[model samples]
Target: MNATDRLTELFMRFPGIGPKQAKRFVYFLLREHFHFKEQLINALQELKHTGKQCERCYSFFGDKNLKNPKSKCHICLNENRDEKILMIVEKELDLDAIEKTGSYNGQYFILGGVLPPLTEKPSELIRVRELVARIYDDITNDSLEEIIFALPVTDYGDVTKEYLEKTLGQIVGMKNIKMSTLARGLSSGLELEYVDRDTFKSALERRQ
Candidate 1:
């Protein structure tokens, strides 16, 4: 493949860029004299080696933590947060959405992805096991009081939540686990990230 085709292939790998937009971006970079091209190349190269996943949250930050990883993130380490009240979310995006609301002061457990038979591998579900182990280890002989399910308000999200609640619920005990979900206000925002701060805040307040 030629340089233009090569650039198109690279850009297409990005989340939302289509062929037309990728071609336009490549041409723009070419006209701009390749500085952006060099920058993109350098960034991608660094990404291959750096920004490892945090062992605790599974969120990709930088490599320093990966070298000497911590069992908890800054939020998880915070003394003020309610360690007894845990919230399980499907992805980092959902976690960020709740954090932006400033409504929840509890610790978080991210599942990394939902359980969809299409792309959901059983190994990917190990994160849920990690959550169970962490709670058992951290809560001083498994005394966690609450676990809020904050997955997206989708049909798939509902199925995943029920599965988790059943599976982990058995290991952790259904009596100790009080399951709650975000309010309907979040439905208006569809994409959790796009929700306004107030909407998210209200959703948390109305959470049952």
Candidate 2:
């Protein structure tokens, strides 16, 4: 177990990275200049100390947010953004994708993960309890008008959507908040994280 094997194992821990890909990452790092490796190490160290998960959306941020330990992410604090609409995405990457489109002007809530069909103990699988509380608070504030489901177009996505809609509907129904999802403009199995700007825009417009 040398540095190469140790680094490979660490890289393999990242989601979707397999043995071959992780090994390639190690070899690529070895081929790069020492300066690049140093920079990478420094960035990781800074993030380790300063990285903060948003209190509202759970999206990770760093820098100034670390200065105020109780502060929310920039998006959550932005007054110009629409408070009446909330988009629920499965992960941070998916939320990032929507932001890059530059068409959305609403709040976001990251559900953390999608659930597979017939999964047991579903609350343990994602941030279900947290989402309910968030929605309840928003509704209480009279700031929430709609909730958009921006989950991926997959089996896991469908299951998660069904579960959330039913569970959240209880609160939404009493509050009269409309719930919608991204339209079928998204191809089957398409991930919101990978959706292109134009495609996402279309889906958003066609959302029903």
Candidate 3:
């Protein structure tokens, strides 16, 4: 493919970009401020270079202890926070959104991605098994009490949440797992960020 065609193809690979959107982006980059092309390239290159996933919570960032330091992520290391309640999120963006509210004092677990049936094996992409082990480890070792699920409202999100709840229930033997979901007052099909702050806080407070 030509260079323009190649860039269009690359842009299309992004989550919400369609062919037309990709073409517009490429044209804009080429025509509007060509200097930004270098910035884009540098940003993409630096993305991999800067951040490493936290060993404990799996949230990736450019923290000092990201590699092998004694301390974990700030949330994981915060002694004042309640480790007993864990909030599981689909993406780091959603985690950030919730964290901005400053309402939730509990720690978090990031699933990395929602579950999908694209794989032949059900266990392929989703890591509910490891998640379960983490929960059990926390309960027995760290004395955790509840798990709040903050997954999106998509089909994949719903399925993954159900799978986790069922698996944890089976493994822990009883609903000793006080599982909860984002409250329904928030729009049924909206992302966590689109909802207003008041509603988001309300949803968190009324989270079930």
Best by TM-score: 2
Candidate 3 yields a Cα-based lDDT of 0.76
Model 2 lDDT vs. the true structure? 0.90
**Model 1: per-residue lDDT, tens digit, 117-203?**
444564465476787676666556454677777776777777787777766767566445566777767355345655667876776
Better of 1 and 2 by lDDT: 2
| Regions of candidate 3 where Cα sits further than 4 Å from its true position | 64-72, 115-121, 154-156, 173-175
Best by lDDT: 2
Measured over all alpha carbons after superposition, the RMSD of each candidate to the real structure, in angstroms, is 3.4, 1.5, 3.3
- State the C-alpha lDDT per candidate: 0.72, 0.90, 0.76
Give lDDT: candidate 1, residue 159.
72
Residue 206: error of model 1 in Å? Answer: 2.0
Model 3 scores worst on lDDT over the 10 consecutive residues at 63-72
Give all TM-scores, in the order shown.
0.77, 0.94, 0.78
Candidate 1 Cα outliers beyond 4 Å, as residue runs: 33-49, 63-72, 117-126, 140-143, 186-190
Q: What is the lDDT of residue 73 in candidate 3?
A: 70
Task: Report the C-alpha displacement of residue 175, candidate 1, in angstroms.
Answer: 6.9
lDDT of 2 by residue, 32-110 (tens): 9999999999999998988888889999988544557574888998999999999999999998998998979999999
Report clash pairs, candidate 2: none
Provide backbone clash counts, one per model: 0, 0, 2
